[model samples]
Target: MSITPQAQISAQDKSYSAKALVSIALAWAFDAMDFSILTFVLVDIMKDYGVPLTLAAAVSSATTFARLGGGFLGGLIGDSWGRKAGLVISIIWFTIFEFLTGFSIGFTLLFLVRILYGIGMGAMYANGTPMLMEMMPAKWRGFASGLMQSGFSFGYIFAAIIYRVWYGDLGWHAMFYIACIPALVVAIYIWAQVPESSRWRKEKSASKSHSVPVSHLFKDGNTWNTIHAALISLIAFGVTYPINIFYATLLKQHGHFSPAIVANTIIILNVAGIIGNILGGYLSDIIGRRAVLIISAIGTLACSFVFQSISTDWERNLFTFLIGLFSIGGVWAAIPTYIAEHFKTTVRSTGQGTTYHFGAAVGGAIIPLIVSGIAPSVGGLAHAMTYSVAITSILVIVLAVLWRESKGSVLE
Candidate 1:
């Protein structure tokens, strides 16, 4: 077998060696698993709280909105303070809030719990992605970054297993409490295993403890570029997230699958997603970011439409798994690397967090509304997803054409 270009290039550097990457990846993976434990537990939550599915979805949507705020705060602080410190703090915050989520006696309490947890969860992609990028060697950055997110797919799979084992007995409250353990573990591991980004530390030493304002993300020549970039990311994320979270429920309700089967299917799809993130990110590093993205977008457009159309249990599981293979998995792997290459280091985390969260929140808010609204009129979830995916794919292509590669681009 021939050696890949990534392997050839990555052979020279060992900065983010196997152990470092694995530690980082594991922390992030658990973070994802902890955050999404709610998805598996949502049915339990709805039952316990006597809420509607839409309302539970709204709790997630509310978390998306809160993430926007958390991203801004975490980005600003992560830039000024240290990336590792920001992450450790955020993990602790999420842990506390997530544990609190179990104690929620009513909708108001649960909403508050999710909102607080969202604050920490929002900062995750912002800080974690950049921190991993800064620590790793450039030649291997794409793979490392993608691997970091691969944990998310694993985490989703883990959540499924956790639900499979526990959902019958321990209940959602216990699951949320268990979720808190991972957060604490990550926080402790971060304190022990990770170091402050050498790049950020150097900058901090040079700056002599001066604090930067949140507005700096848009100041200087960065304003319009940040806006356009964030908008594109927003569109991508807005379309992907809610759909992934709600997909099992969608199949259960519209397609009439058993809950156990739907959960099992989610695990399978998330497992496929792990491969997609790695494949997409690795390909982008080789083929040029734009080319890989266009392929992913086109694939997403097709698969999403196909996914929405299935009527039988097998068809639903197959199509949904494929959807994760293309859309949810592939898109996430490419996004952070794309953003990191665009802006300077000075504002990389901030810009990335702001733009990504902006996309996430927008997608969270709009897609559900659109999908739910059109589901009945359009005759089903599949048709609605087809229309939504088609439109989003076109827009992604348009945006991809407009945005150029930031490979080897200078950071401030």
Candidate 2:
């Protein structure tokens, strides 16, 4: 029930509302679903592509490379033109390539398809947070941010459902085809329904169509701050990607979990995540972003230890639920809000998007490969996750302590 102390909206701007927030989040949901799809269906991809398990895992990370380029370009386009057009173009580009991914015949061909797919992923994610951050009123920015971040969890939840009903019978490729279609529809709908960002429009009018260079982010007072923030995202990716991206595969192959059990667990975890996202953001509005982040980091650290110590399936499930709560919901709830508060409107989208996505690309693309390589040497996937999570949790705590608190700050 906490609120930001003051709400900032333009005196003449009358079009801002929650509907715009929902539309942006809807676009992002597809990105989350696509990312999660690799986790659930990697085995199928390996079998179909005639590649080894390492290559299969590498493909999961492959999109990250393409995304680096996509994020930069999308941010440039969004900042230069408009958030809406950038998103629509990004969605369409990803949708077509993702559909093409289903038809890839060989490992190289599939990898190439996925690289293109990453572009769309990068573009939308780059644009999504800042667009929402700019449009929503200050009082609700935290909650709005939480909802935007949880768009991925919601997408992950649906992917779990899809795996249950359609994945087994229709197969993974069919799932990709089906998932890509919704993205296209969402793109068209976003094009028709969502308004241009009111903040961006107002600024453009005031400046008479001047453009800001992306390189200027490096020259600002936030130069190091941006790097440190991006490092936080990188560490987030390092901890979460290995454990989450391959969790279902671990359960099914090693832990002897039934597909139903895996699907149900995924659903419950993400549902809890959605709640954590909203609650954590609301709490951050009252307390401070750094405090909520520290709380989240400590919770995640506790979860990691509990995970390593526990052996029973029930206990693992309990810990998994908490991990979803703290790691996915808690940490993510404050990130967009925190990042938005750090930069001016002229460079907000570019600065925030580039740092976040660059970290994501490096972590997403590389960590899975490392995990796949180290899992054998480190005893197993579970052990590898334990160590990675432990290290990243400590880093998060350190960063949280160092990063300045931005509680209840209005967006530029």
Candidate 3:
């Protein structure tokens, strides 16, 4: 029997898909490293710069706040030029700022540099996620989304490892300097290996007009989706930052854990998160995106109570793993696929970027500042986080219930 031309093309496509996933996932991992490195060293920065916890926490807030604009600009670039261009530009932009972060002589300088770095971090997600989703086959998109999102865990784990091994010897500045090198390599790899999204190209060719105004997202029937998606994103980021940004501080200040213990615990959390990411993604494919999201939210809420009440070291570790699995891992895995499917290809990047980062601004930026400010009066970081998580998790459940499922929906 002779081989079919269709089969040959299918084989070629699978090969390209594999390459794209690897390349994009690598970039995501490095991006994670850069963003998260600050969390690990935040306490140290406070002592070194003679700043209060609230001021130091503001550094992270500034970065996340800037992500809102970066995400919007990145989506516009992706929509207007090409996904690949937006991605490459974002990678380069972040890498440069991350490296420059090493040179900051004061807290103000560090805060400003990080805000710039945050923009690049936001742009990377805006461009890379849509590109990956468009390249994947419908049946596999859930798993692929899960796998891509897991790069965040991988990056967190890498940052943990770097902090553990190098921080004592070389200090935090070296950590920022080291993170930029491999990220640049990933950018070059993406530039050379990853092709532009075929769906974006097709949409561009088929449309009568070249330019789609940003107003289109809020016009017609899209207004509700645009609003709902951003709301969900806001809740997601709001719930997540309380746990993620402050976990180390909680363990160190409240629990009085050693540096080694803190790093190891974080590693455990991220490992569980990685597993949750894959599980959530796979389950979303099997059940539905909405269902998985609801499950994650409910699970996170239950676990937060358990995590907060626990006393023993062993119990703390166990619940930490659970929090990572349910909250950090599962909820995020389904987000990219769910949100990207909300808009047509012509406006998909813009919709995904703007809505997602808008959430980050309120949830990620403002929430942390609130947490830091209220910690002393509220009982400390742990209690403030518990209250925040409970409220946000409830909101997520409400939002997830309201959202229509997008699993297996064909992209335009």
Name the best candidate (by lDDT). 3
- What TM-score fits each model? 0.90, 0.93, 0.97
Error of 2 at 189 (Å): 2.3
Off by over 4 Å in 1: 1-20, 309-314, 410-412
Q: Over 4 Å off in model 3, which ranges?
A: 306-311
Residues 118-229, model 1: lDDT tens digits? 8888786678777877777666667776777788888888777777777678877777777678657767877886667777777777775466555766787777678877
Residue 10 deviation, candidate 1, in Å?
12
TM-score of candidate 1 to 2 decimals: 0.90
The whole-model lDDT of each prediction reads 0.74, 0.79, 0.88
Candidate with best TM-score: 3
Q: Compared to the true structure, candidate 3 yields what TM-score?
A: 0.97
Collision count for each candidate, in order: 5, 0, 0
Give the residue spans of candidate 2 off by over 4 A.
1-15, 305-311
For model 2, how does the per-residue alpha-carbon lDDT over 1-412 read when each residue is reduced to its tens digit?
6544443334323345565677778778887787688789877777776777788888777788788888888888888888888888999999898788778777898888998899888888778778888877787888888888888889898788878899878987777887887788888877887778878888777876467667778775778767876887787777677766877777776777778988887876788788888888888888878888889878888887544533476786788889889887887888889888887777777777788887788776677677778989999877777777777878888988888887667666
